[model samples]
Target: MSETRSDSTPESGRTVNRRQVLARSGAVGLGIAFSGALSELFAGTASALGRSGYGPLVPDPNGLLDLPAGFRYQVLSREGDRLRSGEGTVPSNHDGMSAFAGKGGSVHLVRNHENRVTARFAVPTVEGITYDPQGKGGCTALTLDHRGTVVSERVAIAGTAVNCAGGPTPWGTWLTCEETEDRAGTNGYTKDHGFIFEVDPVDPHRTGAVPLTAMGRFQHEAIAIDPQQGIVYETEDAFEKPFGLFYRFLPNRPRGGVGSLRAGGRLQAMRVPGVPDLSSVQETGASFDGIEWVDVPDPLATRTPVRLQDFGPRGITHAQKLEGCYWGGTCVYFVSSFAHSTEGSAADHFGQIWRYDPAAHRLTLVIVFGPDTEVQLPGESPDNICLAPGGGLMVCEDGNGAQHVFGVSRRGEVYAMARNRQNIGTPEAPEWGEFAGVTFAPDGRTMYVNCYTPGTTFAVTGPFHG
Candidate 1:
């Protein structure tokens, strides 16, 4: 079994320090006020921990979003809303996104639409702009003016499958991943699906609609690129028996030479010693030492499950539903959506957050969500995560009941930041949808998020430095 070092101490089967508690019983705000090292999460506020967030969320008069007292929001774009190009409407199911600085002091966003191959709302069909006409899943680029208003929105890339969550590259591009593993000629798709495509935030129209096949062909969820090492860390949202394995792509050139990732790279899976069956759901706050990566024989899973066949016997660790990831504070922080013990698992938890330190060669458990209930931990399923301009991480919930964008302090205290208030529910088709595409603008003055339902994108601003 591999060994792990905790706070410079050898992990010879010892308990974690009590002060190292990752999460409290209820909201993270309660824990932050008492946590000496993490009290800065709510620094300027009163010492008393009265409310859960910056303040009570003021109800939006338009009935779309509800944010804290001082925070304000405006709609940037919505599904079915006509684009500034007047060519097509904004696609539905806005899933993941990243923001970039534009020419005229504007912010450009390359947003994903999690629609399947057969969707009612299709991106605009243009010459030399789509990958597969049969597949309706793709990405859209929205240009926002200096005032945070939508300047022009158009189809950036088209003809993909289930363009879900992706990350921004230091070289100024968006790596959009197709969540589905459906292959060519299956399900009406002319070409094989499930690959990462690069979308140019500045001008995707000129960017080739090509998939970075070297990244691997699997059920992709999100990715975070280490700028210094030119390594791409990815997550898989698979829930099958074998589950998904966390991956890192080491490009042929350590610094991503002229060809970048398209130059072809080696795919490898992560391995942590001491975890049996390679699953981490059973362990909470479990530390590991001597992390290792094993090479993948095949990047594409043609005959068998790529995760199971390549890393299962090799002892590579597996996560139930690893979702979002972000590179911040010289480390990579990611989320394991959810897993349980009822299905013969090691442990059960609503959600989890992990931190991987490349320099130290360590993977640490940063946050763990407890069991779910009607009232406690209202935001359960953490889908996509992003780093805040100030400190801490913002998580978008994809779980049940009321969905919200949750904030986790550096000390691991979780609090509600925003909630969806759109009431478009019907008896047959529910209206509530999880929040996705949570990103901050270049200047850090504004934060943009999406409500997946009647799809609306919001630009939020407030005293976020709390």
Candidate 2:
């Protein structure tokens, strides 16, 4: 069901191998070669002081997740485990997640389950929150103490499909996006999919099963809301011809609290004049000014996808595998998780990070992961990403070979913060799943991430430094 590849052989000692990779690439301790707005952006973050992340990863004896020496992870929930509410088992395909502060030193996490109709465990169909009884994907809410121990876990929303990566709102709610365009009766689905649903972290009852249809329905991957104007920037993960387009939803109520998005909004796709395909740009510092926004003729895609909608002569810009989005500093950062010529892309690359400056009306390439054969490094296709509390960025690998959660410093130094040693296959034919939902506690003391297969959630803590 989930994607996996076995290109590089599994190694025993990861520290030596990681160090050797960095040394050979001449990337250790060296400042990022390109200097401009990117340097200024990293400089604003506290962790961008050019310090390498918490050294090499130490292999776990349990053959699960490997982390840095001082750091350790606690299993919060597993796929087959019964939830604290005793309603149903934890669902499979843990994806996008967000952490919020709760009363009495508790923290609330609203996590997404990227499950479809055939998933083994579905988010229990709660009466009021069930959107479609036959649908088998949704979200769950987890409560943790200050010590990062799970206190309560329960279904927050149920009966959706393909609950993939989503973004947290400034008003303390999580916008879960469905990464599918399945209409009613497609694969037994009772309703249309590919819409964003808002979930409340503190109160599940407030988050009824409501789809913000104004956000445009076309294989939604992730969203980042500009805290200033409440403009929601979204990424599409379509892998077919014509690729996917970047979108921004201008909400009617702006930064209003949860459920405000349902009031209605105007959706628009981005256009960069001559740049029809984003992957064609290879240079790191390439800038596109005078950006334009084309109104999506049909946001609901009743007849056509938003990306495929005609926008006069100057068509909307599209990119391949657009995923992972976060709001930081004064811009909204989004990722393009690699492109391939064989996959019908204009150009090829491992991954790319782009920053859109709403104030300046400019879009700039921040970080570009060049073509590399080593899947063990950070240059692999980075899926879910977050601005690390200790500085820099935390990335989840969904690429090839081995899977890892990598730390990229402000100086462009890459370090392996954690590795996936969970072999879901035979010893002779090992299989590793991708990492998703990397976020931090409200106090920044603990980090929470999900291993997407066999569905495991972990809370990692230690001497974290920026």
Candidate 3:
């Protein structure tokens, strides 16, 4: 973790303290108004209390996941578990994922493996869907019945690298992103990496190894789609000093079904007139109006990286660790996992959640996580995020110490929903891994999440609020 920095912004009058932002949650529409299960979370006053959610979480007797008393989790898949297809075992480093409706009332989960060339278990390279034979990262599909029992699992796409966080499309497809900018011959990769690939939940054949180049070639993290205009919003998770830029793609064929993004689109990076670094602004409810989008001169990054490209005098805005992204209500929600002044960020903080309203051409800071002395707490570096079926938000912690899945209620209260007790390390050194891919089934009955290390996926069900 980085040292904490001053929570001051250059702009005046627009900045508000975190406490004030929570107190005026209703006035600023703090809660997300997304459709379906993603409706109202963070609408009321925000509370930093730990027990405000479903009460204290009870320890699990199985030495796996600890949840609240009434809630229970079933292990759907593990890293080395053999796939039903017999092609290979489940890959390592399970990251971004999304759940879709499957055949006969089942649920189909498309998961990503953040594997590199040195990974032990690589996503099996199926003939037609394999992109680059040397690339060691890709996605897999898991099927769970209504009873939350594993039905079948297989490889969705293969021959990619560093498959990190991605988002789902309104047209029932999953967009898997590669968080890398490695070239073909650099890392033994036969093809250029760092592009988004669309995967169809039902049919693996539909998702060939074609990368959506029009979506830009950079260290892609996650993406969210606007259903109305079919605009695709993307986040770049570049670890370099310049950090990454937020992008939006205007697809030629707006909302077409599968394989539409491959038709090519105009990619653009976001720019806030005077704001060059997002971390510099620490005030909650800090809204930036008149947000501008600059067209990328080279989306392919054939010469210069997208973030380094010239974007006029008022260059594009950059954020460190730009991770999880989702489309809710009429706006797009994104997360800057964390920032460190030591790492060249303008400031330091735990995390931030920003809402971009396309209709209003405005961007507002809905939530700002203050520095936490205890890294094991709920409000640390929040990575992947999703809406709870009942209401509120579910966040994955990627900070130090104990890792947990936190729930933020409609009133903005944060609580521990689940904890990972799987000790992948030795008993003398007990190390717990971070959580990722927090999503809910369409029926709102089952919640699915992933454990990054030792790579495990679990389906949790209980008396949810919805």
Best by TM-score: 2
For model 1, state the Cα shift of residue 103 in Å.
Answer: 2.2
Q: Which runs in model 2 stand beyond 4 Å of their true positions?
A: 1-38, 47-49, 374-378
Query: What's the lDDT of the predicted structure labeled candidate 1?
Result: 0.74
Model 1 clash pairs are 2-273, 3-289, 4-288, 4-289, 28-413, 28-414, 282-347
User: 60-112 in candidate 2: lDDT tens per residue?
Assistant: 99988998889999999999899999988999999999899998879999899
TM-score of each: 0.87, 0.91, 0.90
Q: Which ten residues in a row have the lowest lDDT in candidate 2?
A: 12-21
lDDT of each: 0.74, 0.81, 0.81
Model 3 agreement with the true structure over 348-459: per-residue lDDT tens digits:
8788888888876777777765333444444568899997774458889887767888776555555678889998788998789999999999988888999999899999
Ranking of predictions according to TM-score: 2, 3, 1
lDDT of 2 at 91: 92
Q: Count clashes in each candidate, considering only residues at least 3 apart in sequence or on different chains.
A: 7, 2, 2
| Candidate 1 Cα RMSD after full superposition onto the native fold (Å) | 5.1
| Poorly placed runs, candidate 1 (over 4 Å) | 1-52, 257-259, 276-285, 342-345, 371-377, 427-431
Superposed Cα deviation of residue 213, candidate 2 (Å): 1.0
